[model samples]
Target: MGTFQIEGGHQLKGSIQPQGAKNEALQILCAVLLTPEKVVIDNIPDIVDVNKLINILSNLGVKIQKLGKGKYSFKSDALQLEYLESEQFKKEGGGLRGSIMIVGPLLARFGKGYIPRPGGDKIGRRRLDTHFEGMIKLGAKFRYNKEERFYGVEAPEGLKGTFMLLDEASVTGTANIVMAAVMAEGETTIYNAACEPYLQQLCKMLNKMGAKISGIGSNMLKIEGVKALNGCEHSVLPDMIEIGSWIGLAAMTKSEITIKNVSWEDLGLIPATFRKLGITVEKRGDDIFIPAHTEGYEIETFIDGSFMTISDAPWPGFTPDLLSIVLVVATQAKGEVLIHQKMFESRLFFVDKLIDMGAKIILCDPHRATVIGHNFKSTLKATTMTSPDIRAGISLLIAALSAKGTSTIHNIEQIDRGYENIDERLRAIGAKIIRTA
Candidate 1:
């Protein structure tokens, strides 16, 4: 396990570039399996989860060549289908949840897909029903091995395209189904699909590779099966979740930082949601400039004088990923707000760690928390804590950076799974943080 020792109460000032989106990269990387040609991708984030997926692909006999920093070429012409049934493959694939996405493309191309139970952050119960059910709708045979905790799908005669209304707009599930449908025969219509920018980018990339897909940014998507897909180059967007985390860190520590190369049009409802907590965000071209909050900010209330509520929903709504950062920033604001994490059951449990750091927070339930801002009247006292998940780890890091004295955080690997070189990047901008093994 690694730990971060952060010395707090420092004002940071500078500019930093946000890393490429992790979520989008996962979907994009898995799509390489859809074609046998070389697919070159740029702006790939150097994070643990992404690297793990790449390693898994290499183990499956996919040829990968590193062209440059954040650039790679993937060709699956030599893919080994037999590796999917190996014990070594199960061990590698079971470590990350993103590995499950490979099932769709594999089933589409090779007529078979198999995966062991995947693992990820302990935030909620993420089920694979949406993915399996979607594939079954397309005429794939599905089976589960209860003793082995494995899932397998096969379509001996090829998949047939059909209309599917998903039980929910699961992002990974939608991406999986779309990848499988592109090679199937006939037309496929998907209603209530996830419309996040990640999914939109996936559709655009698929279209560039000769797949016919419509509805780039809407909940409904239409796809026409293609005989084959050609390889194409794609660049991922900036990580909006990381950008939001930087915004919250700047606000709590009174820092001024500029996040560069952020696709402003793609970051729906994120900046506006932070603005509700009285943080000032300026857009200069493709960059978001966050000024230091010398004068403490206040949370905005409704017109009827009720407490403001910050909750999460699907795309075009506030993202569930940024709610943890919002909850942390609200602690130092001038008013009270209720945070409702509707998507995940246990995401709000990290509030207890924030409360231990001398913030006023009420854990209403597993999915809700009410935060009363301290308004910089009383400084937070640094202490020891363990990070629970990717978002929560960064939230605690921000809290530690804004608190008085030194704080120690254990289990920093959770943070590294998403953010790329977070400690080094923050240090360049005047944050006093050190990683220790």
Candidate 2:
């Protein structure tokens, strides 16, 4: 395990570029399996999860070449289908949630898909029913091995497109179904699909590769199956979650930082959510400039004079990924706000760590917490803590950076799973953080 020792109470200043969207990259990377031609992807973040997916691809006999930094070419001309049934594949594919996405494309192209129970952040019960049920709707025979904890799908008669109203708008599930439908026979209509920028970009990229998809930014998507998909080039958008995390860090530590090339149009409701907490965000071209909060910031109450509630929903709503950062920032805001993490029950439990750092927080339930801002009146006392997940790890890092004295955070590998070179990037902008093994 690695640890980060952060010396807090420093004002960071400078500009940093956000890594390419990790979520989008996962979907895009998995999309490469839809075609046998070379798919060149740019702006791919150098993170652990992405690298693991790439390694899985390589293990499956997909030809991979690193063109440059954040650039790669993948050609699945000789995919080893037998690898999917191998114990080695089980070990590799079971390590990351993104690995589950390969099932859709593999089933679409090769008539079979197999996956062990995938793992990711232990935030909530992320069921795979949406993914499997969506595929089954498209005429695939689904089977599960209870003893092995494995899922298998096969469409020997080939997939035929059909209309499906998903039980919920699951991002990965939607991406999986779309990839499977792209090569199926006839037209497929997906209602209540996830419309996040990640899925939007996936659709756009698929279209570039000869798939006909409509409704780029809406909850409903129409796909006209194509005989084949060719390779195409794609560049991922900036990581909005990381962008929001930087904003929260700047606010809590009173730092002035500029996040470059953020694709402002795609960051729906993210900036506004931070603004509700009284953070100043200026848009200069494609960049979001966050000025230092020297005069302190206040949380805005609802018009009805009730505590402002920050919650998560599907796209166009405050992302559940960044709610931890918002909760941390609220610990230093001038007023109290309720954080309702609707998506994940255990996500808000991290508030206990923040409370231990001398912040006033009330954990109302597994999914709700009320944060009363300390307003810089009581400086956070640095202490040792273990990071629980990706977003929570970064939130704790932000809290550590804003606290008085030094703080030690173990289990930093959780942070590295998503954020690319986080310690190096933050250090360039005056954050006093060191990574030690």
Candidate 3:
């Protein structure tokens, strides 16, 4: 396991460009399986999870070529369908949750698709019901091997479109179902679908590829089945979660950092969410400039005199992925804030690591945490810790950078799964962070 050795209490300067959205890249990469023509994707983040998906696609006989940094062209004209049942496929495809998406496209184009239960962050119970149920609604037969813990879907007569309402608005589930619906026999209407920017991007890309999709950026999505889809070039948006992390990092360490080329309109409540924590998120054209908080930031209170609560919800609301960053930044704020992470159960457990470093935090439950800021009057003492997940790992890194003395973080592979060249990127902005194997 590699570790990060960070020298704390150093202010970072200069600007950093956020990498392409990891969430979007995962969906777009899977969409490549829907077409036989050449699909050229730009702004692909060179991270572990995305790379794993690409390698899986390559192993399945998709011809891939590197165009440039963060650019790749993929053609799925030929595919090894037998690979789906191989031991190699079982091991590689089960490594990440994104692999589950390939099943939708494969089942759409081919007669069958099989996959081992996918693995990802052990944050909580992430069931595959939504993905499978949506497929079943589209006239696909679903089967599960309880002994092997494997799942498969088959559309022997090909998929037929139907109207269905999802049990929940799941991003990956929505993306998977959308990919399947684009090749169904008739019109498919999905109600309560996730309208995240990344999902919207996937729909637009499919539209460009000859799929008729409407009701974008809304809860209802309408898809008309196409005989076949062609390839197209698409660029991913900057990762909003990473951008939010940088904003929280700047405020926590009292740094002046500018994030370039952030799609401001697509950010939806992220910038405003950070501002609620007393951090200044200034918009200079398309970029976000966060000034140094020399005097520390103060959390806003409710008008009724209740404590400020930051909670995650569906789109247009604050994203749950950045709640960890908000919780970490609130440690040094002028007031207290309650962080409610509704999406995942075990994500808030990592706050205990911050509490060990001299921060005042109350773990109210598995879903909520109360953070009392030291207001910079007290600096966190450096300590050794382990990363639990991608978001929590970055949050801990931000805490380590703002703490006193030096800190060591084990299992940095989790951080690497999301952020591309994070240590080098931080170094460019004057942060004293080193990666040691």
Query: lDDT per residue, candidate 1, 1-437, as tens digits?
Result: 99999999999999999999999999999999999999999999999999999999999989999999999999999888888989998899989999999999999998889999999889999999999999999999999999888899999999999999999999999999999999999999999999999999999999999999998799899999999999999999999999999899999999999999889999999999999999998899999999999998999999999999999999989999999999999999999999999999989898889989999999999989999999999988899999999999999999999999999999999999999999999999999999999
Q: lDDT of each structure?
A: 0.95, 0.95, 0.95
TM per candidate: 0.99, 0.99, 0.99
Candidate 2 ranges with C-alpha deviation above 4 Å: none
> Distance (Å) between predicted and true CA of 259, model 2?
0.9
| Clashing residue pair totals per candidate (backbone < 3 A) | 0, 0, 0
Off by over 4 Å in 1: none
How well is each residue in 1-437 modelled by candidate 2, as lDDT tens digits?
99999999999999999999999999999999999999999999999999999999999999999999999999999999999999998899999999999999999998899999999999989999999999999999999999988999999989999999999999999999999999999999999999999999999999999999998899999999999999999999999999999999999999999999999999999999999999999999999999989988999989999989999999988789999999999999999999999998888877788889999999999989999998899988899999999999999999999999999999999999999999999999999999999
User: Candidate 1: TM-score?
Assistant: 0.99
Residue 390, model 3, lDDT: 98
Record all residue pairs in model 3 with backbone atoms less than 3 Å apart, i.e. clashing. none
Q: Least accurate stretch of 10 residues (summed lDDT) in model 3? A: 104-113
